[model samples]
Target: MTTRAWVLHPDIQTNRDRKDPQPALEEAMALAHALPGLEVVGGEVVRLPKAHPGQLFGSGKLEELRQRLTDQEIGLVLIDGPVSPVQQRNLEKAWKTKLLDRTGLILEIFSDRARTREGVLQVEMAALSYQRTRLVRAWTHLERQRGGLGFVGGPGETQIEADRRAIDEQLTRLRRQLAKVVKTRELHRAARAKVPFPIIALVGYTNAGKSTLFNRLTGADVMAKDMLFATLDPTMRAVDLPSGRRVILSDTVGFISSLPTQLVAAFRATLEEVLAADLILHVRDISHDETEAQDADVRRILSDLGVDENTRVIEVWNKVDLLAEEEQLALIRQAERREDVVVVSALTGLGVEALLAEAEHTLDEVRMRKELILSFSSGKQRAWLYDQGVVEAEQQTDDGFVVTVNWTQGQARQFHEL
Candidate 1:
């Protein structure tokens, strides 16, 4: 059954926000839509000077909105901000509807979208942590009298405490399981290290055309959708660059503004791919009104993940096809002025070659040219160099073959280790 949902973005006047309220409301509605079986009947920005402790809205305003929700038959109300457990319970009781906050809604979407075992476990842990704080709301039945022997003076093992304990136990178990999964991932990363291919990770705001760009670059049909968080599990594919260098391209979960803290902690293992990336492509929907704010959000998340200061990041202004021709020309001109920015339409393959060239050039800028001498007896090393496609030129000398190669520090280290 499709549950009717009403989205409300509380515009806290005292709080300073870089984004406009209307866009925030729209994003909340889109998040509500991302979950299946939820039909958003109405959405609006609710102005508030301050939040009420018991209920988020003022008494009269709450009653007014409650009547409107009843009239509209909204079964669910999604608040696009934090709601204390007490406030949530009070609001739900007063409004006669289920209530979900921004964190809860995002967690629901993640629970529905997580495909991998690691992703599932992470979501489960995050949800449990969130649920743990809401045990007060879950103990509504505790108010009812319980028939029991009067052995203990006080109520024995309150429902809320029991529920919290259960959730804690489950969280512990999930952590153990997550540790195993993370260990396996570490092993996989170690194996990939032997291949010596630079990993390029794509990161940006949700629905920023990262998967589309991934598909365009690697010819991999990852799910590309207009909806937020269309991609959750980290996907990797080897892509041959314009320079004939093979690099691993990783498409990771899209970031969002005000991302749930639980999610950041839970998905740390998944985001380690970004930390290990040789280059990060911060994709942006150039046509979106909140693109600048979204860019800040992505950077904040990256910084939280402890991304290296020296890591190379290229700003990919994507979705240029949606822009006007004049706007597109202006953006292209702007990108031409900066070496780190590339404007491309991933859907139409427009300027994608340039993106690839830029990626290659950025990776190549760190390369160190070295002269290596290989005797005839060292045929294996020579074959390895040729296979790597790093051998720029080779000349046979009386003693051996002098090979000039251009390779990254990592590749050079790998060769010496071999």
Candidate 2:
């Protein structure tokens, strides 16, 4: 199959700070490069001087784009901006090509890349939810069954009704399946409570070098790339700290501005991976111009997810290699004043050891301290306590064993129950 795309964007008079159309065009090309069958013919940034409620851009611009589309022989229209369902349908009709918004493009990339069952389910759920809202006409062919299997574009007797019904059914089943995944994840969380190792989740804008850091620390080759959303499914690996203690380090889906709401809801199962984390490492591109704003956006998202409170979040200024020595020094000075923030270059491995040591120290510090005294004869019980919680400070007396255990509040209760 030959794949070609035309890019479109509608920007208001304000919000000039929106990502340059070039990166989005570059993103489209990058995705096309990753997917073998894809070919990007050409792309243009059509600025809408005034918004058209129905079409998003003026009819005159649409006419010019249609001529360009015909001349270029483009098969797909990729909109770099958000579009209403009505606008999407109208644009497809007007342009006479398959139209995809930024959301749809992301979903397509995710659909192709998802490997694990949970990953596939999450992508399918997002696609289904997005498709449900759009309800584009030609998409009906995607649903029909013939010869015991549905060919995506095969002509069918009962096309519309069969496809819609099947989509609905698949959606229902997908929801249930996702619920089971969520339940299994919750069970895993409970198991983690049995041994409270502090979790550190790496979250940042896609292509900000999260997977590289994950591989460097954990020795797991999880598709490290310089492209966007390289790792859709959350991958966790045990990171052995310098003290021989291990903690769960999760490489989660990278964040971006204007993430589709459907995608957010659909990937809740995967996102719960972050919720269980005891600490969050907000890796960022320090050299990027939008670093602070991107940081703000990430914080806003974490707050929306209700993971902000009491979470030991450390802002890691990653990719400092892109900066000069003076700039690096300035960033380090800035980091010194900011609590729970550090500067490090994941690419060159600069300051990574210090970052890890600081993370472990912070993890050790925030734990709830408890005072538990047990008789010396309570050998098994004492051993259980020792196994369950971290002994911050211990003193074995002749009459008994007096120990101060540093654990989460939940673990403290378990100790008392023992």
**Cα TM-score per model:** 0.87, 0.81
Q: Which candidate is the best by TM-score?
A: 1
Clashes of each: 0, 0
Q: Per-residue lDDT of 1-418 in model 1, one digit per residue for the tens?
A: 9999999999988777635899999999999999999999999898989888889899988988989999999999999998999999999999989999999999999999999999999999999999988877454455643444668665555666767788999999999999999999988986787676998999999999999999999999999999999999999999999878899999999999999899999999999999878889999999999999899899999998998767889999999999999999999999999879999999999999999999999898877799999998988788778877789999999988999999765566557766
The most accurate candidate by lDDT is: 1
User: Global lDDT for candidate 1?
Assistant: 0.91
**What C-alpha lDDT values do all the predictions have?**
0.91, 0.77
Mind giving the per-residue lDDT tens digits that candidate 2 earns over 31-111?
A: 555554667776666666656788887888889888899888888888876788889888889989888888888888888
lDDT of 2 at 172: 95
